[model samples]
Structure formats: C-alpha cells, structure tokens
Target: MKIKVVFLLVVELLVVIVVVVVVVVVVVVITVAIAVAVVGVVAVVIAVCVLRVNFVIVKVELVIVVVVVVVVVVVVVVVVVLVLVLVVVVLVLVVLVREVTAEVGYSTGSSVLELVFVIVVVVVVLVVVVFTISFVVRLLVVAAVVVVVVVVVVVVVVVVVVVVVVKVVVAMMVVVVLAIVVVTIVVIVKVFVVIVVVLLVVIEGEQVVVVVIVAVVAMAVVVLLLVVVVVVVVVVVVVVVVVVVVVVVVAVVVTAVLVAVVIVGLVVPPAEQNF
Candidate 1:
C-alpha cells in the first residue's frame, strides 16, 4: 500500500509538472507572437504614414496578414501537439501506476486512474474552450480592422479620381462638393466604428471592453481632426491624418486585445474531482 501511494503521488507530481511546463511554453510562444505582430503593424504604419510608398504599403499589409495567419496556425498546432503529448504521458503514468498497484496486491487502481483521466480531460476541454474563444475574438477584431481599412482605401481612391476628373472637366465648385463628401465620409466612418464596437461587445462580452474604449478614443481623435479639416477645408490633410490615426489606433487596440486574450486564456482554474 505504501509503495502504491508513493507511486501515485509521483504520478500526480509529474502530471502537475507537465501542465506547468506546457503553460509556460504556451505563454512564451504567445509573447513572441505578439512581438512579431506588433513589429509588423509598426512596419505597416511606417509604410503608410512616414515612407508613403504605395508598393511598400501593399507589401507590408500582405506580410502582416500572412504573418498573422501563420502565427495563429502555428500556435494552435503547438497547443494541440502539446496536449496530445500530455495525454500520452498521462496514459503511460496510469499504466505504470496500475501495474505497480496490481503487483502489490492492490488491484483496485481504477479509481485513481479515473481521477487522473478526468483531470486530463478537463484540462483539455478548458484549453480548447479558451483558445477557441480567443481565436474568435481575434477574428472579429481583424475583420473590423480590415473593413475599416478597405472602406477608407476605396473611398479615398474614388474621391481622388473624382477630384482629378473634376479638376480637368469642371469648376472650383466641384472641388468644394468633393470636400463636403470627404467630411461626410468621415462622419460615416465614425458611426461605423461605433456600430462595430457595440457588435463586438455584444458578441464577446468582457474581453472586448478594451476594443470599445479604443474605438471611442479613435472616434474622439477623428472628431477633433474633423473640426480642423472643416475649418481649413483641406482634403489632403484630413485624409492623411485620418488614415494615420485610424491605422495606429487599430494596431494598438488589436495588440492590446491579443495580450488580454493570452492572459485570460492561460488562467485555468485548478480542477478538483472526488472519485
């Protein structure tokens, strides 16, 4: 009995150690991924705002998207592989414990085995749930960012083309009309931002409050810029300022949420099961 108890304790200790190691590995991986993502976002911002190279902008954006997809896939794969490894380790431990107990004339090791199995299953379930939620939250944020970027880009391009055509074919009055259109688009963007935030909050609840705050701050900045644009009636200035502010805010907000999800997901409560 003493030998069996000792072996059971060792098995439990090994399981705990494995879990801790896995968590640490996951946290490290997420931290590195976040760093890479932030770097990519910064590069994109520089390409758009500072360098102002059109091709560079397209390249950086593509790189960011590809990097994000790869990182997510790699993280999920790492997690699943590690979980499988843990399961295998636990199975081996279970078998060893059963053999040891049986050889010692204590054949009823099923209860202990059941308890360990339950713990492993519970751990796996919690991990899957956490990652799934995190992934969904991230997908929503990325979608919102993409929507904002695409709309802004399409509108800006259309407005620029119209302004050029109007400059050649119409009077200065047409330019004024285009200015009004730009301001109207700015307002529309603000409203869209609010709607997206509300939808995200409703869908994800607690973890998404960070995104709401970010959207509100972005709107406030845009509003201030709008006042300036209205006073100066400068289309070029408004376009550049709005683009920079929106892109930066989106990047920062997404990065913040990624970190939040990582922390939230890793925090699994200790499971206790009485068999």
Candidate 2:
C-alpha cells in the first residue's frame, strides 16, 4: 500500500510538473513571438527613418545648390550689364572728345587736346580694370560656394549611410542572438523531459537508491540549465544594449520556469508507510 501510495504521489507530481512546463512553454513562446514582432516593427521604423533623413538631406542640398546657382547667375548678369554700359559710355565719351579735339585744335593748342584725350583714356582703363577685377572676384566666390556645397553633400551622405549600416548590423545581431537563446531553451526543455522519463522508470521499480541518485543528477542538470540561461543573458547584454530589455525579460521568465520545474518535478511523497 505504501509503495502504491508513493507511486500515486509520484504520478501526481509528474502530472503537475508536466502541466506547469506546458504552461510556461506556452508563455515563453508567446513572449518570444511578441519580441520578434517588436523587433520587426523597430527595424521597419528605423529603415523608414533613415530613408526620410536621406530624402530630406538630399532635398535640402538640392535647394541650396539651386539657390547658389541662381545667385551666381544673377551676379554675373549684373556684372556683365554694368561692364557693357561702362564700355558704351566710354565709347561715347571718346567720340565726343575726338570731335572737341578737332574743333579745339583749330582754336586751342593741339597739346591741350592731346592731354585731355590721354586723361580720358586713363579714366576708362581704370574703370575697365576695376570692373574686370569685380567680375573675377564674383566668379571666385561662386566657385567657392559650389565647392562648399559639394563637400557638405558628401559628408551628409557618408554620415547617413554609416548610421543606416550600423543599425542594420545591430538588428541582425539581435536576431541571431535570439535564435541562439531559443535553441538553448529547447535544449533545457528536452533535458528536463528526458530526466523526468528516467525518474518515472526508476521510481516505478521501487528502487530508493536509484531514485536518490537520479534526483541528484536531475538537480545538477537543472543547475546547469539555469547557468546556461544566465550565460545567455550575459551574452545578450554584452552583445547589444538595445536587445537586453527584451532578452532579459525572457531570461527571467525561463529561469523561473526552470526553478519551478526542478523543485516540483523532483518532489516525491514520503515513502515512510510500510508496503
């Protein structure tokens, strides 16, 4: 009777352990699914943000280039107009001076007419030189603006590309780590199941010594599973800070489940009653 009672207790405990394990596993699966979904959403959001940043940066750069080009064109046009007007004015003044010189040479000295003409020529040359220098300076300024725009565009593109690549790499790493963690969980579950079956067989034979020995081994296995989980959590934390939040939640849950199973699954009703 005592042996029968002990067996019944063992069966009840196994049933309870199995139920608890199934529930915990279901919870873990649901949580992992949610985490994966969150990860996918985050990745999509990041990709969209990166594309938007690139678009905005390109649009702003294009506008800047267009504005610079327009300003340069306006400046050159104004300078050319001014130069043309100055040349026309100088030509008119020369023609008038020539007429005056012809008239003056008859009344005034030819030397006086020559001197006035030389001064007029010198004034026109100075004005032309100044205008030419102003045009050249404007060209240089426009060139400088173009070079600055090119450099700024290049730098912005490089920064955006690097940011996007880094984010992609981090996301990939998180997924890989999660896969490893899932495999670990599955292994822990398998080990627990094998240990439970072995216990069922050993305890059925009414071998107290075998049961005690198997129970010790089972405890060691449970400890090992917990350690594996801890190591995985540490690895996840080290690999990426961003993934730690989700992975840590999973680690806590799985560890709790392992602890519960180890304690409950190993429990055996007191075999003190006489058989």
Query: Considering every candidate listed, which one attains the maximal TM-score?
Result: 1
The list of candidate 1 runs beyond 4 A from truth reads 1-60, 107-110, 140-144, 147-275
Q: Each model's TM-score?
A: 0.40, 0.28
lDDT by residue (159-243, candidate 2, tens digit) is: 3323432333344344334433443444354444445555666578577677667866876876585566547554643544445
Q: Which consecutive 10 residues in model 2 have the weakest lDDT in total? A: 105-114
lDDT of each: 0.45, 0.41
Q: Model 1 compared with the native: what TM-score?
A: 0.40
lDDT of residue 197 for candidate 1: 45
Cα error, residue 115 of model 1, in Å, equals 1.3
Best by lDDT: 1
lDDT of 1: 0.45
- Model 2 bad stretches (over 4 Å): 1-149, 203-275
